[model samples]
Target: MPEFNAPLRDMRFVLHQVFQGPALWARLPALAGTVDADTADAILEEAAKITGQLLAPLNRSGDEQGVTFAAGEVRTPDGFKQAWQTFREGGWVGLAGNPEHGGMGMPKMLAVQFEEMLYAANCSFSLYSALSAGCCLAIDAHASEALKAIYLPQLYSGQWGGTMCLTEPHAGTDLGIIRSKAEPYADGSYRVSGTKIFITGGEQDLTENIIHLVLAKLPDAPAGPKGISLFLVPKYLVNADGSLGERNAASCGSLEHKMGIKASATCVMNFDGATGYLVGEPNKGLAAMFTMMNYERLSIGIQGIGCAEASYQNAARYARDRLQSRAPTGAQAREKPADPIIVHPDVRRMLLTMRALTEGGRAFATYVGLQLDTAKYAEDPDERDAAQRLVALLTPVAKAFFTDTGLESCVLGQQVFGGHGYIREWGQEQLVRDVRIAQIYEGTNGIQALDLLGRKVVADGGQSLKLFAAQIRSFCASEPPYADAVLHALGQLESLSQWLGERASSDANAIGAASVEYLQLFGYVAYAYMWSRMAAVAKAQRKQEPDFHDAKLGTAAFYFERLLPRILSLEASIRAGSSSLFQLSAEQF
Candidate 1:
């Protein structure tokens, strides 16, 4: 079996040396005294232990046994319930939750590292906690005080699990067409009747109760998405005194047998006249749900990074130990029958590509986490607004780009093992199977790309893209390592943004036609910016930690030399416009 040890040193480098997370935390009053470098390190270490020791052992077994459903009850695989108890006891579910609600109140900058570790150790196990965290975030952001007081504590404590129920059989991406209905009652609650599909952890044996955030349309509302509303519906109703009352009408009809992450119960949740309280205003449910979706989008992106990291570790180790053929020039291991595959140029290319993308993605995810912290905790209004805008602009890229390259890296890692990678015991195949879903879920990568190009970039007339470009330009002014290359990439992005804006004005289908490529181009440039920053930091600190920092410098060079140029072809594809795409009609196929 493959092994997973949290890359603590690299994580520390990103958190401390590359991003200076502690200094930024100190600047934000909400996070000033909450955590420091030592505290963050301790938290990360504990998280590593729990994930690497407890959860990782269950990853392969969990995938094999999967979840079982009987008599309308969903049971997780063996050892998961015990692991959940330990995980909850550690208060990890609410690592970044609000302090007032019994949470530890850690900044996202730190919580992101823990999340990566969770998914790396076990993606299936990680989804349970990830959903709960996202559900808590949405409720805390938009729920009433009474609702928060009643639900937040239990959800944060992990006594109860949480899920976001948005997709229905008839509605997946176009939520406006959903048929779920919410009927108002005299007692100020609504009777929610909806059949939501693909609900993660909707009905699980790991927790006492499951809190579901459902989306439905009210009776007297306008048509389309404006008619939608968000409701807090639980599996078991809670009495005024906070004890569990009779079972609500919500029940799991069945669990979807999926290709990967099989341990996670992808449930068909049937809410039959379930008692639900409105969260936030009616006709604004999508807005409230976006609070959770954005969080999940980023979380799913980390899922990609986690899987890639795990795959890279196993592949790198396997290459070093598995001897295949003698080196072209000479045998480095004369005592052995043949030199290790690591001596081969092709193997080196695959391993280096994996390392470069995984490390660059880590830096990029951390950067987004820092923006989340700044957006929420910054004292200055202008600063907070800027950070929030950056969050909006970069989120889709983070989601799509990370997963796109994440899958690429995993495939490369699998290829490193040749036929062994195709088998189940080695665990490379599992990583590939598990990470594939990241690209499909959380508003498929295609939707994410269109969101980036149509909504975030072109919708704003390139203003948001310019805001990002300005930051890169500001960094380029300092002339750090790879600054010239980064600046040139930034220029290409700017020119492309302008070109896209012009095309969008002239052609309605231009954005959709070019969205996926546009997002890929943006992703490459964004990672280039991250690699540039990491290179500068590693170059300056190479004397202190030669092995670590030198490796970073080497990877940064690899990214700039090999991966960064992918944007050139993406740029050309975007410039090609929608004409070729439209040439084929619906009848052509």
Candidate 2:
């Protein structure tokens, strides 16, 4: 595997310099006094150590020997169990969880960086903890206090792991079609009977207990998504005194053989009348499940970013070491038979594209994290509400755009390696394979685009989009050096949003046809906005941190000159409308 190194300097720049996360934390009552720049830096530094040293070494080895399953149980690859223990003992699982429930209560702003490191180091191992974090979020938000008292501590402490059970054999995207049934029991628990597939970490040996947050339907429930209900089905039943009891009826039927992230166990779960406890109000499961889904979407987006970062690290290192050709003008390394590949203009372009996207993405993801923190921790109600609205509007964009660009960046990274990239030993191929799932899972990029364009943007009468536009306008109003460029891109995005909104109203298929392109356009514009912000900060800090700020400005220039031009093509496609998409008949072939 390519040597994995966490980009701590860039991560710090995004958090403390571009976003001023510590400043934001100082104001939020929930984070005030608990978190500071020094504290956050120390934590991230330790995370970098663990990810780069412990987890990364096992990445290629784990992939070579995927999970093994037999006799209704699954075992992870060698060293995963110990690495997971190290991860748990470090108090990472509950980093963003409630402190009152044995959690660290870290802000999302910091948690996101830690997440990126985990993914970049080893995505397969990261999923186990990632799902656990999402499960903790949903349970903390909606689960009963008694339930919290019993499960929260165990989950956060890593005595148990978590998984979300939604997809079944017959239904993947359509949760309403699920056949999982939950029958009421006189003892206040329900009997859950159904099977779920593609369940990550559904059955693993890393933790002693596994908690599955399942979606099911009640006997007298309404039709469609409204009929769904969320349940907490444990692997081992918890006794009245919080001790382990007999095993539950739930068991792993089989493990999924997948294209990538092979080290992570994707199980086929069968619940034969398993005991379950309802988390929220009856018939409100869809809404509750979303709490976890949204969290996973963002994390999966980070998964893409993580892979891109890893790819860039390996590619950049290879470019500097591989001797290929001399520079156009002169030989940088005259003593050598040929100059390093980095001397070639085309390779430099590829490397710059990878750097520009990865850095811009880090800033963009941190911005979203800040919005989440504002929504969850801000003191004022109106501020929280506004932040929540922005989070809702941008979640799909972040999820889809990051993954799309991440995949693009990975391909470019592979290109830098040429023939070496095609082989398994170089590790670039694994990145391409691993990151591909990010685009497919979590409701797929196409589904995310539709959610952004049709549901989030169009269904709300463009209200959420307007909120976002207003934010970009406010930022541009600050009058930075690149304010004009930021303003122009924002203007283009706003105009396109209006154009798409009006066109969709007249043509029902307009949104669906234009969604993917619109999302790419929005993503490019969003990255441009982030680049502008970073450039402004870099320009101001140039005197203090000359090299770092100069590099930031150079990357910002590359993004503006080379990458931002992508929006032009995307805009044209969006305006091309739905006519071409539906022209082909189903039986034409």
Candidate 3:
């Protein structure tokens, strides 16, 4: 089993040092009574325990057993159903949801920690909860009041699960090509008819009811994404008394056998004239579904961070304990048969690199989560707007960088285990396989890059980029002990941003082609800012606990010396964008 002790410590540093959760919580009325340093700490401790004890024990078993479909029902791997029951019983489903709708109203900063822990423990089990949270968030924000009243509590409590149905056989990222149709009925209901593919947790007997947020076009709707609308199509319709009524026409046609995260139960769903009610409005579903998609993007990034941290722990431990070769330097443990692998420079490099990236990724995710919270809960419009821009700018980075690093780190971990990693039992190979999907799902990293460059950056005239750049500058200008390194990293980011801004001016395709690489550069720089701030704070509190503060300084130095230098490579890619990206004609294939 993977140990999560270091991860928990890093989570605390991110929440308190990077984002300053306590101070921010003080400003929001919604978080007044529920969150504080102590409360947040308590939540982290409990979450760590649950993830390390309950979830980690089953991660391998779940991966090995996966879920079996028999006679129209899906049987999740052993202990998953029970784990899910406990997840619901603990009110975890609503951790970042609306309190009025029976959600815990916990801020996203706090909620993101759970998201990472779930990824660390078992990405498969985490899917059921993650989907429910996102589904309810969209519903709470855009669904009818009646729908909110009926479904929010159950969904938040985990009595029910939710699924996002957007992709079909003909359409994946190109929703404009989707063929799902909605036909109106007399009782203000609609019949949803289509088949949705790659729907995670789409069909399972884990809960009493499953709520599906389906996308379909109306009879007289316009063509393309604009014509799409979201619908609340439950497997079993809820009565006025909140009890299950007749089963809707929707059914799971089959399950997808995927490369990884197999316990998630991806389904091929067939909606045979399923009775459904519109979520927000007709011919406006795609816009509304973006709400869920955006949330999922960030959540997926958290998955990457957790998996990387888990991999780092396993690899670090293996390197420290495994003794095979003598130390490069004079060995302190000379009495032993051979020095541990940790004594090797390259092995130490890998472990520290994993640590630096994983920790930086955690800080980046929490910072984004905090901005999201402020965007929704801040009293001032200016503050809210500022936070919103950061959210939009950093979201793609969070999704792409964290997951990309996650895959890299997991692979490095597997390499550390040598031949044993190729086998599943040592657990290194499973982590690699499990984290791979984070890069592919919730919109491919390539598509997300396009969204960033085309929509958020160039199309917006680099307004979001400017706002974030200004934020980084403000931090760099501060009188921190390590101001030189922080300023250097921040300056690199600014230069990269400038280079991107210039290249994207005339070339429309540049944004799409350069988006992923730029987004990663953006993430590294932003995390550098965070690490600098954290180290400064830790230094200020040197009298309190030098270990924590010293760790912050060391990690910040590691980021500056090692990770922050990657911006030069990414900048080149962004600058080279559109030329090579567009060079390939259809015949090039």
Clashes of each: 0, 0, 2
Clashing residue pairs in candidate 1 (N, C-alpha, C atoms within 3 angstroms): none
Question: Candidate 1 at 554: error in angstroms?
Answer: 0.8
- Where model 2 places Cα greater than 4 Å from the true spot, the runs are none
lDDT of 1 by residue, 485-576 (tens): 99999889889988889988889989998999989989889989999999999899889999988899888898899889998999989899
* Better model by lDDT: candidate 1 vs candidate 3: 1
The true-versus-predicted C-alpha distance at residue 75 of model 1, in Å, is 0.8
Error of 1 at 45 (Å): 0.6
Per-residue lDDT tens digits for candidate 2, residues 438-487, read: 99988899999999988888788889878887877788888865678777
Local distance difference test scores for all models? 0.94, 0.92, 0.85
Taking all chains together, the TM-score of candidate 3 against the true structure is 0.96
Order the candidates by TM-score, highest first: 1, 2, 3
lDDT, candidate 1, at 227: 91
Which residue pairs show backbone clashes in model 3? 229-285, 230-285
In order of appearance, the predictions have TM-scores of 0.99, 0.99, 0.96
Question: lDDT-based ranking, best first?
Answer: 1, 2, 3
Write out the backbone clash pairs for model 2: none
Question: Whose lDDT is higher: candidate 1's or candidate 2's?
Answer: 1
Q: After superposition, how far is residue 528 of candidate 3 from its true place, in Å?
A: 1.3
